[model samples]
Target: MVDASQFEKLTTVAKADGVQQLVVGAVVQHEGKVLLLQRPDDDFMGGIFELPSGKVDPGESLDDALRREVKEESFLDISAIREYIGSFDYESGSGKKSRQFNFSVDVRAAEPIELTEHDAYLWAPLHDDLPVTDAVKDVLQKYRELRAVRRD
Candidate 1:
C-alpha cells in the first residue's frame, strides 16, 4: 500500500525535478469480454482505442482510482476488482509530463458506458479481432495468459 508521505514525496520530486511519477489505469473486463474506449478528440491517443483509465488521484489507492475512473468514464459500477494485472509507462498525449501505470481489473459487469466521455466502447472477445491500444494489448495478453492457465 502506498502511504500518503510516499506519494507526497513523489509529487514533490515530480514538481521539483520535473520527473514523472506513477499513474494508474485499468484494463477492466466484464463477462468474457474486455472493455475498451476511444480516446476523446482532445485526449491523448485521441481516436486510438485504449483501456478505460485515468490518472490516479492523490491519496487514492490504485484499486479505488480504478473503480472510480471506470464508473465515471463508463457509467458502470464494478465489483470484485482483482489485483494488478500489469503496468506500462508512457507519456500521455495529454501533455501531463508524467508516466502512467495501467492495471488490469476484473469486473462482473458494467452498467452502461457514458458515451459522452468517449467516442465509442467495446466488449471485445478474448484473443479475437478487436481494436485496442498497445497498452491494452499488453494487459489483455496477461489476461489471456491467466485464462489459458486456468483452462488447463
Candidate 2:
C-alpha cells in the first residue's frame, strides 16, 4: 500500500524541483468496457493505445484540464468524475519526467467519439496486450481494483 503522507511529500518535492509534469488521464467506461484511443502513426508513442489524456495547463485545475483534454481529443464531455484512480510516473518520449494522475469519469452524452488526435479507438476491459505503456497498464489495474472495491 502507498503511504499517503509520504506520497504527498514526494509530490511536493517533485513540484518544488520543477522536474515533474502533471498530466491527467481519464478512464471512461460504458457497458462494462473502458475506452481506449489509438494514437496516430506520426505522434509520439504512435500506434499505441492510451486513455484520453493531456498535460495540465499552468492556470487550470486538474479536473478542468481533464475535461478540456477529453473534449479536445475525443469530442466527449465528462459528466462526472467518479473516482481518482491513482498516479504513476514515467519518462515521456522527449525525456521529460512526467506523472499521470488518472481518474474514472462518466461521459456526459452517449454520442459517438469524434476523434481528432487518434486514428482509432477501442472499448475493452483490462488486459495484458492492450499496447499501452506499463505505467498506463498500472493505472488501468488501479481503476479496476477501485471499482471492484466499491461494488463489494
Candidate 3:
C-alpha cells in the first residue's frame, strides 16, 4: 500500500526545483481496458499514442486540471480518481522540461470519446501492443501495480 503522506512528500520534492510545466495524464479504465489517444499527423509527436493529458493552467488545481483535460481531450467526465499513479519528467518538443502527474480515473459514464486535439482513440488492455512514450509505459506499469495491490 502506498503511504499517501509519503507520496505527497515525494511530489513536493520533485517539484522543489520548479517545473517548467506541470502536466496531468488521466488513465481512464473501464471494463479492464485503458484509454489511449492518438496525436494528429500534423501535430508535435504526430502519429504517436498518449493518455488524455494536458498542462495545468495557472490557478487551476491538479484535480481540476485532470477533469478539464479529460473533458477537453476525450469529452468524458471523470467521476472518481482511483489512485495517484505517480509522476515522470521529460523534455517537450520545445526543449522545456516538464513533469507529468498521472492518475487512474473512472469516468462518469461510458460515453463515446469525442476527440478534438487527437485524431483517434483506443481502449486496450495495458499489456496490448501500442505505440506510446516511455513515460506513459511507466505510468501504466505503476497503475497495474497499484491495481494488483488493491485486488489483494
* Residue lDDT tens for model 3, 1-152: 23457445644765696767778899998888899999999888899999999988876667788889999999999988777888898888788788888888889986777998998999988777657988898888888888899889
Q: Candidate 1 — which residues are off by over 4 angstroms? A: 1-21, 94-97
Better of 2 and 3 by lDDT: 3
On TM-score, the leading prediction is 3
- Over 55-123, each residue of candidate 2 has an lDDT whose tens digit, in order, gives 888766677888899999889999887777877777788888888878889998746889988999888
Taking the tens digit of each residue's C-alpha lDDT, what string does model 1 give over 5-36? 54355446555856454566666776778777
- Model 3's alpha-carbon lDDT is 0.84
TM-score winner between 1 and 3, please give it.
3
Candidate 3, pairs of clashing residues: none
Model 3 stretches with alpha carbons more than 4 Å out: 1-14
- The CA-based lDDT of model 1 is what? 0.67
| Candidate 1 clash pair list | 23-101
Clashes of 3: 0
lDDT of 3 at 81: 73
Q: Write the candidate numbers in order of decreasing lDDT.
A: 3, 2, 1
